[model samples]
Target: MHLTTRQLFLSHVVLLAGSSASALAAPASKTVSLSYIARLYSMRTSVSGKKVVMKNKWNNIEVETNSRRAWVNGVMVWLHHPCRKAGGGWAIRELDFKKGIDPILRSYAYVPTKKPNMVVLDPGHGGKDPGAVGTRKVYEKKAVLSIANRVKAHLEAKKIPVRMTRTTDVYLTLNQRSDYAAKVGADLFVSIHADSAEASSANGVETFTMTAAGCDSSNYYGQSGDKSTKRGNQYDAANAVLGFSIQSNLVKMSKRSDRGLRRARFAVLKNAPCPAALVECGFLSNPEEEALMIDPNYREAVARGISNGILGYITLVNRARK
Candidate 1:
């Protein structure tokens, strides 16, 4: 029987999930060896101090021994658990490999099987809600809207359909933003924002996806807060793929510090109607980053990064369809 694109995609997701259940449930003793991963990807492996570097012709992965930090093509991606020494070698939890590295490396197996029909770009905060106010008086809402507009332009140039939660300066509650995405049948949703912190030293580019069921969020509050599953957990695997794609290209294009692909239970992410990610362009509290936010050239670069990341995800979906 011939299946529609959506049906085929659902079937593929089920098959993939079932096939990996055993591996995912494996005990700590059965953690995946870095050596095995290197061999699987045909990458040469070497140890440098406390880190292991795996390099292939096309990609490179660096895992910090006994740490949750890892880098793929120089973009930092946090692991669910720290790499540990098992069976006389460094290995990572199976979930980390499946949900983090593998998805980014082999996205065709994890991303949606159908190309996205519509991508919703959410420029977070507006109108009465100015979001983070930089030291230079740059507003997060304005910066993100400008950046989102540029991103929409880039995607449209490639013939990809795009929608915005708010095209102009207007306050939108978190629920309203997500509801709009659902109403418009958004295949993928991205919320853009500028971060802020009391410590001016905190500055970087990061991407957040919904926290997986029973996993602690990467942020401090989440470590002590709820770890319960949410609606977005249904797309956990795909979120990893999309989140990593955005973080990777965003860091490369923005030339910002790699704060790593992170996990959070933000309202927009948790309530998303489809696979989604939130991009923190930079910290508005930091003088340097705040200045960059107001720079036209910087905004253009960030926009390109976000657009490229979405295009990369679309490419993966197309490849999966074939």
Candidate 2:
């Protein structure tokens, strides 16, 4: 799909919605029709086979019937629950609308009241925990720490106060990371790490926010039955905005395959004191990405991507305040 320059710009506008609160309060067991969403956004809707497509001059949303997969503006986003048939129409769960779609579509209503005063950066793994080990002895912990330091430099250059959970090769538990962020009064938290999989072909970058309450994680793909709520669920909307920002910038800067924004219930995210996102830079198990992780230039690119993402989110919040 081709997008004009104006359309691209419109996709980034963080506008407000009038009935966001009521829409968010819809029951978890209930579903919202795609037609309603189209009307809310002033977009036209059509059905082609199993997919429902909604589009305006500026943006487009495509959702598969009876599936959790969706695409917004050509970017794939995983919904918390699958879309299903409701009254002869396709609909998604209320939680998915509140935590996933609405925030991405209208972030101004979801942003924090104040601009972020401080950002806490957590580099995954440390001394005792090697994280994912790749070819040529490349370590995920070391790579992420280097990247985090670079990101700190970029953010600090822009006069943004930044702090890290650990500066060196020291192991810290997940609880300690979240606790430290809370103690420091962080307005935003970002955890960085590389991924690993048995299949070396699994490559690309993805960002994760806290999974909504009473929903399965993106990784589980609706298989898990865990529906427990977490403290981080309070920032579900903000998480989506932040995650989308990070993933969008990261993919643009790294020029990597877009794995889309996703959701998970990691300890750091589930207990985060503020809006948070966890970024998987790339898969260490993939030979190509593993090599790229060890390169200084590549690391710089990734850092710039993450820093720009944070700045983008801050800009949205500042705009919302105005």
Which regions of candidate 2 fall more than 4 Å away from where they truly are?
1-26, 48-50, 222-226
Models 1 onward score TM values of: 0.89, 0.89
Which pairs of residues collide in model 2? Answer: none
lDDT comparing candidate 2 with the true structure: 0.91
Candidate 1 Cα outliers beyond 4 Å, as residue runs:
1-30
RMSD of 2: 10.8
lDDT of 2 by residue, 5-79 (tens): 778665544232243545444546778899999999999998888889999998899998888889888777888
Q: Judge candidate 2 at residue 137 and give its lDDT.
A: 83
Against the unseen true structure, what C-alpha lDDT does each candidate score?
A: 0.91, 0.91
